[model samples]
Target chain A: MPSPARSALAHIAFSDLVVLLRGIFERHGTSAEVAAVLATNCASAQRDGAHSHGVFRMPGYVSTLASGWVDGRAVPVVEDVASGYVRVDARNGFAQPALAAARGLLLEKARSAGIAVLAIHNSHHFAALWPDVEPFAEEGLIALSVVNSMTCVVPHGARRPLFGTNPIAFAAPCAASAPIVFDMATSAMAHGDVQIAARAGETLPPGMGVDSQGLATQDPNAILNGGALLPFGGHKGSALSMMVELLAAALTGGNFSFEFDWDQHPGAKTPWTGQLIIVIDPRKSGGESFARRAQTLVAHMHEVGLSRMPGERRYREREHSALHGVAIAEQELAQLRAMTGD
Target chain B: MPSPARSALAHIAFSDLVVLLRGIFERHGTSAEVAAVLATNCASAQRDGAHSHGVFRMPGYVSTLASGWVDGRAVPVVEDVASGYVRVDARNGFAQPALAAARGLLLEKARSAGIAVLAIHNSHHFAALWPDVEPFAEEGLIALSVVNSMTCVVPHGARRPLFGTNPIAFAAPCAASAPIVFDMATSAMAHGDVQIAARAGETLPPGMGVDSQGLATQDPNAILNGGALLPFGGHKGSALSMMVELLAAALTGGNFSFEFDWDQHPGAKTPWTGQLIIVIDPRKSGGESFARRAQTLVAHMHEVGLSRMPGERRYREREHSALHGVAIAEQELAQLRAMTGD
Candidate 1:
């Protein structure tokens, strides 16, 4: 039986978290390399202070493994590859491996062709995007990625969930600070936040979600029951969401909203959901000056007092966590411990 | 002097309209070739039913020429060229020539590099973006462009105008039909429309603009009295507008909101704004299969009863206009006739 009482909050070293998480993943059948990559991504998220996407997601990922939804031992294979593009069939593999592999392949292609696009299908969810993009930034390339999901959002005025949160992430190399990364969901709010609110039995901020009858509701429970999520910017956000859905689902030949079995497999449905990745080496265009000009642009923006750069705050958070251990809520750690039976 | 306002509507042949506009532009020192390109863009907009950007903008373009803000005889020079990126200095030249040169350069680079980005500064406003992007789409490429202007909009909660009514345009190739084109302003209503409302002594739609106190108001005059236009989708739209500003202004090294002098030079100050263009060759990725998959996606969307494909209605309008000459409002026709002294 699971413990009703929670474990106390503890300062777990980043290395310790990785070891613990990897052990659990390996025991669940993931290959050592794949488990390590997944754990590294989780740790990166925690270090970046993105608590929602960090270890908090592990309980669900492990649950997916137990239910056989995420094939821990599966691998991705190339379906087709061109001078500037590639298509990968994940073979129901863990998304971290698929994403990492695709990113590497795309960077290689981009080096030669100046730009490369990778379409990945049939993979499990990879919780955080920055980890996938930061590497490209380190390599001095711009990276953009998008993913579609099981429908949990309504088009602008519609009453039913017809689209996914559909995230778009962009990372560009900067001069002084870390790469400027912009990661966002097309929806006003994400499903994870709604689930968190529901679990806490709390009301959501108004305008983030709606009830089953299409009325705006603060109650997360009502929002979860056949309710629809709102777009970030009304029609414009809806338009971008639809675009992501096309690139990720339609382009890669993955199942979309209605086609997915949402009830049985809720980490955004399709046993083989798709994602698209793009990388561009700016040196291929304007040489080193591309980076110089990009840096100048950021400096000009800072001159106007825009507060923080796109990814600066998160990078700072990661720096802080490196100096002082990450904070894990007692309840969350307890849940993870119970799930992994560690 | 203006011939007592010719009230009767007249149907001018589309060819004649093009020739007449071209002739006027040539008379203002623009080269015949540049005039032809500019005229073609306006004609296409008229054909596509976008009157706001078509001939309605001609008088303004010519006035910029007359005021010596736009260098009709000047040509764009490539300031920086990279493998897949280019930056052009328009030399205060007309946008048609600058844009044509930039677009051609980008497309040429994209053919080999897979993708290309071009940024232009010191250029006059280009009237329509579709003509600039459609040619690339015909070759199975995707394109995106953005333009920034003088301050005309308020940040989400601010009362004073602090940003431009920036515009974004995107186009993607289609297999069986015209390429999908979408162009929109970040503001709920454009400054031109607001000016028209104020001139007609009419009120604006609710939520369109705000008064001096940052309160929403429909009174166009009040909104124009030290007030400002509101963004389309509150904070999200504001952020997008800011993004556009940064891309078009900062990246292109053009004047920004606080730096613009809209009234003083009319042509010199804010007239030489910035623009960015991107072209992507899809064939470099999925080959013929890409187009086929895109068709399937469009079909699925149409099956879902979405209003229409991105550019379907516009293409239809163009077809209708090609068969039968376009409708020209009497007042507008008279204005054109007077401008040309016909």
Candidate 2:
């Protein structure tokens, strides 16, 4: 049993955590600046209540790097940019740099034209897409970002894993509230969540997963072994996942389902993944005064007693954490300290 | 009870539908030009198997017009355009002409700027987003079109209707197969289908809708009166509905839920009604020749046994209908003839 106040847990300050993460990444061959950026992103995720995407995943990422799956030192290089379109090659680089380069280029294109699409190939996993979309939303733009990972979910009616837990994120700007951002995975549950459930010895949620025999089941172990996560809805979610695969993987020149299998080979040294980021400047796309009207609409929805805007709650959480540092479960804190050899 | 025919029902000449629809619209105060466009759009929807969006919707539309809810004689006019971004004042015109004009202008902008977005305000309902999307798909471009209609569905937990059955359509050019087009409503079932079931005295499918008491129910009558259609998969689907509304309505100067009582005013007369259409040129975006790589990615998915591409089945249906004219249910034919006084 876990205790709320366990002595094994140490409360390392947020800054300390960032420094430790940067140190670890630097030791693993990441450049100093890149390590700092990666550390900041990890910390930000934790602040935003996205603990699943935060530093808790750092150990697995390092293991991937150690296994020679991800190149810690690679950098993103521009492939093309004209009019309102941009193409980027990550050169087997960390996803952060690639995403950064793509966003920068996309902003440039959007500033020049009314809309811009940044297609990126050969990138590694980019953490929670909300961060990538937020900056664009802050600039009064509407943005959609998607990425397709290695296969982990099954199509509707199929037993085998044939698609990634492809996630799509969209952000819209508002004046008073935080930007409305909706980020989601097409699968009923992400593979990482399933692994967590298995480790916890808990039954998976109904309709979330299936067993080796192609029947829906609640056993996480069975799903992790040979079964697959079902899509959110039957065919609609499957169609959405395929759409993401084509847009992110196909359009960006990355491998699709059959070309790369996460099950056959688990860790890194896998083929480079793909991502798509689209930005629409509301000011440019819908006349100069569109953002103001958008703000009014946001206010209207809230006035009607909608609980919260998509990202507003997250933003509120982040604000609270920034004022009073975030709290982690005692067990997770202890694990982090052990991993750091502190 | 309806019977499934071995072969499709007898062909109803498309020209007959076109002429009848045109005559009906003309009698309802639409100009000859706008009526022609509307008829063409309706015919195409039927051809593509989207019978819900085709001539079946004509009766309700006519009633709205007869009640002075829709402005059938108005013409869409340009409100603003800067840096490839455009805003159109539909003047409550028929949706087909207004939306088509926006698409044409956006394509022209894309030709010069590589990407473009067109925001249309005060437009009436547009049927079958596929037809609107396919034109861009045919031009070797990627397109996304979305519309926020009268509030029809509920958000995740809410019993009252708070969101429209917003539909998002994405179209991308493919190599070997037809263009990959996905058009989906955020609700578990489109509201039109509920109406269809109600008219036929059939029970709605489980999870399709909710009764006025906020209980999930299959009774279409309750759903029509005050019940809400649940989002497809609860939170995720609700998030998508919000996404479409923000992008389509907020940015395009449309009314938010609280601003308009759609039940009181079914026709699109409010100045707040709006839509957003985006067109992207793949040739200008992806690296090392996007078209060739798009073909490769699509083939790889097919090779992995996807069974069918996203738009392949729908395109096949359209092809079959073109070879043998579209089928009309006996009751539908009678209703159409009576409405048109033909």
Candidate 3:
């Protein structure tokens, strides 16, 4: 039904996409190496069909850098406190390089001690979290990471917004196939969706948000005006948000969703978030049979349906896109090219 | 208009309940020390108003012993293999004593290493998980635990049951007040609720379960007849279940939900389940200001709502029951008294 060469259905070369992103970041004062890492990650997301976090978000990052809200040239500093604990101060910069630098040391510690924790503070993480966790899983390790964001979502039941759409990402290594990874926001709906619904004058699904009086409402306009987003699955999702606040913000001595100051974070910048990541070597915990056993479990899920595993669809998208290149909408491509001043 | 003492409002002294439970466990071959730990945990659950996991589940444990499903007299053996890793071979026994023995050592490891992982296998975990995590939080440590159970919940989009309701518990300690704890199952509805609904001829919520043909249905009768329960929040909850299975069961060399052998378990017995508990010293991660910071977060939540915190109501119940006593239904009390052959 659609031609690959058509403007509406064009597939951009993954390398070209990464290069364009890298050039933009480099122009904004990020080191070439760091820009490459960040750009590669963004490109990979687009390749894997996570367009929301991929090329679509570049304009946000550009505006953040233009407003001088984040220090684009800043490099992270690492601190190894204890045997299994490591801390990285992103120094009010991007989270990509800091997370990258911490990963190798974390893997070494987990291999020897069976588990290791990495706490990244003063970081602005705009990218999807799975890229950060999937690397560990690919290296035969289990990884979990959660990060706090600017206050955009509400807790289970409260009057005001005090929590973030704090997302959690987890990955497990498989012996016979690709690693299984899933990343999800704790909010019932992302703010962008609520905004679009409001602009379209469409009623939202119940439980997506609340009104100014903290009463549940299906009106997106009310949610946009003064209300807040609800947590997914009611109370369970709220508890998870609390856990994320503690683990990512409090534990790292970073900004909680409610505590982030507008003075320190100007414009529409990524908040100075904190991420806590745990990497574990399954060989020590699960014994030598861990990988084989994981494969069996993965196969069982696949036996039933097209999508049972958490990130199966993502992986499938990745496989096809790797060979065919990433799909880019014509309008989106024009916007991306406009950013490059082409 | 509630009476202090009525047939439906019978109260039992917490001490008396613990003593009775201790006697029953001892009669079934558990050592006094292990019985004391188990009984204290069970009694606390009742006092905290978690009736489902409290005295209500004692018959399940008793039946486990009668069926030789667990070795009541078994003492857990802890093997400290790595710096930050500890494995407890529960030796096919109750999880209470095994967890009790592992707690102190875990604290020491976490204090020194900043984080520690405890993988427990061949254990029957039937009680509330918060008791285990709360102790760590009380000691100024952060704790997270997840456990897998017999297959009862289906993965998202699957017709057959493939995962457990698999509960996850997390706790954070505060400086000025009680610790905050939250534990939840990943199912939209517990299997027990479905069975009760079916027997009572009540319909269920739309997304709670599926019928024999795997179509979403509200009919409880259809669910009971070769149907399965759904995960909470659809795929997100299912991902949590998958995470639990990997962290708790697969990582511990125990059974995945589908792999749980019913042939080895009979009657109202608890099956051999695995639990994975992680303990981290916030002092190492967050520095000395951790507790105060945590208290501020907790206070902020309480400042808005009556009970936004997950275990706030439970804590209130505990304090009331401690001052007075646990209120138990007369019919339920008679059943417990009968179990004790009083």
Candidate 4:
């Protein structure tokens, strides 16, 4: 067998990758605007070594678009709801475009009110959630976001799957370093990671999921096929998952994780649900600068013998990508190029 | 060994318990208003069977006050910072009174602006977090809160303790039932629970903590004596704990868990940190009543074989308490009575 690390590799400039992905998205039925937003998001993920949400998701996005399960060209309708709230109807399109359409107004409200919330519904979210919040932190604001996906996780103490692998993402600015950011799935293992492991014919760690018989198993294939994932951290993680359902779906007037049915669209691969983003302007906080205080906390974390911060690896990957280009498998790059009619 | 379950139990009316606790607080140091707020909070915890934060915490409160580590008579100063922000300087007092002082304004802002945040600093929080949020849910709003405690938990991948047993609590209204509520310590175990286990001469589940030598151990006494707890769910829980420190302490301009040193006042059991509460008015949402949507989700959860929901146990205990009075160990009740000079 070929050594995986020594396999043929392709490296592309981040912008070139974004342009290539944009071509693929536009060719796959998305509007140029939607393509631009999604391509950048996907490219950024790839550049930061977030493979599951990078080019790995392109086929899923394409298939869903081809199946007509999502309206790639639908325009988002932004609502200026209140002093501190903005709502968006994604019109059956992807969530990124909805956020892009409402981002300016959301920022304005957050600045003026000290805090603001954006509610996007009737949308499909199939990307990493960190992207939704990180930019706010870059702008010296704190941001938190939650998105509920299709049900594949069992609520704690439940006999079967009833909740999505709901995820939460948070970002905060720091003084002399990258913004602190983390995006975590409430499930013991993210569905995409499980898929990756199954594709690689790898076994999983114990307690990640159960087989169809509801017995514990370490086989990734079992978890992916007729089995279910468990919530991370037991009941606490389950409760956070439930909270995600409430905030993203119930509060945003979108379909619950289990409410959407796509069996009729056989190629559909996206969950039609909702997303919530909250932005807070730290200038309104008391005493010292929030970023400086965050830096101090990070310093203490290092002092306590921590070798890495939660999102530090991503930052390192980002820097490496800046110097050496975004890495990809040569075979996958060829497939992507072919999809764009190269 | 004696059967703990068969221990003699004492029952006291919830209101009576509040009055008793209030007298104790007032007699110790607090003003009537502060006493009223804390007494009710403490009594409610006992009524809901949250023993870790109920009567068991009163001695710590008294000792902290008597040692002059906290100003029980200090008046919290509430500031209307912005359309969606409220700030409270707790004046080195308890967080509950600060929250009480700003809550009315916070609610008005949340209703008017759609969402609002309250930042309380220079405060000590030594109570169950759920009580801080549950009332907001009962008032038809969504609430989430975080508070940082004294350092005792080791961040994931860190060799020593640096983070507190920081906790996050959330509450949301549900139709046809009590609100959904949860209060979770990001730590593998709450410090109070470890203390309780140590007092009972019991061992803890594995992965809960490390001894002073930084080796994993199940002995609760070791965890309480110069040892440290671990974050729940490993890295994910550690990230949440870090986020708690940023939100509750950094953003509020309060001391980080490791920043405060209470050695001068030897009996100081409280962490003089900060707290943050975010409230949202669901009326601003696009949904068919948010509460009704939540109810639909809960129904589906039950259909999927979930036998109980988060916070259901607390509600059940509360119902029992209402019917038969709040249950407490007979010995503990005697101690409480003596403390009140009754």
Best by TM-score: 4
Q: Give the Å shift of residue B99 in candidate 4.
A: 0.6
True contacts kept of 3: 0.64
- Candidate 4: Cα lDDT at A263: 91
Model 1 chain A scores worst on lDDT over the 10 consecutive residues at A1-10
For model 4, give the TM-score of chain B. 0.98
Q: What TM-score would chain A of each candidate receive against the reference chain A?
A: 0.91, 0.89, 0.91, 0.98
A168: Cα error in model 3, Å:
0.6
- Tens digits of per-residue lDDT for model 3 on B1-342? 011113476788999989988887887667898789889999898788776577767777788787777888888999886889989989988777888888778888899989999999888888878898998998889999999887767788776878877889998888877898988889887654565466456778788887778888898778778777788987889889889988988898777877756575676457577899999888886454778888888777766563556787788888999888887778767777777765
What range of 10 consecutive residues in model 1 chain B has the weakest lDDT sum? B1-10
Best by lDDT: 4
DockQ of each: 0.28, 0.48, 0.62, 0.90
Candidates' RMSD to native: 4.7, 3.4, 3.4, 1.9
Candidate 3 chain B least-lDDT 10 residues: B1-10
**Fnat per candidate:** 0.13, 0.44, 0.64, 0.91
**Each prediction's TM-score against the native?**
0.86, 0.91, 0.93, 0.98
Q: Write the per-residue lDDT of candidate 1 for residues A176-207, one digit (tens) a residue.
A: 66776767778887676777677666677778
Model 4 per-residue lDDT at A303: 94
Candidate 4 lDDT tens digits, A1-342: 111123487999999999999999999999999999999999998899888888888889999999999999999999999999999999999999999999999999999999999999999999999999999999999999999999889999998997899999999999998899999999998898888777777888999999998989999899888899999999999999999999999999988999999999989999999999999999999699999999999999999999999888889989999999999889888889989976
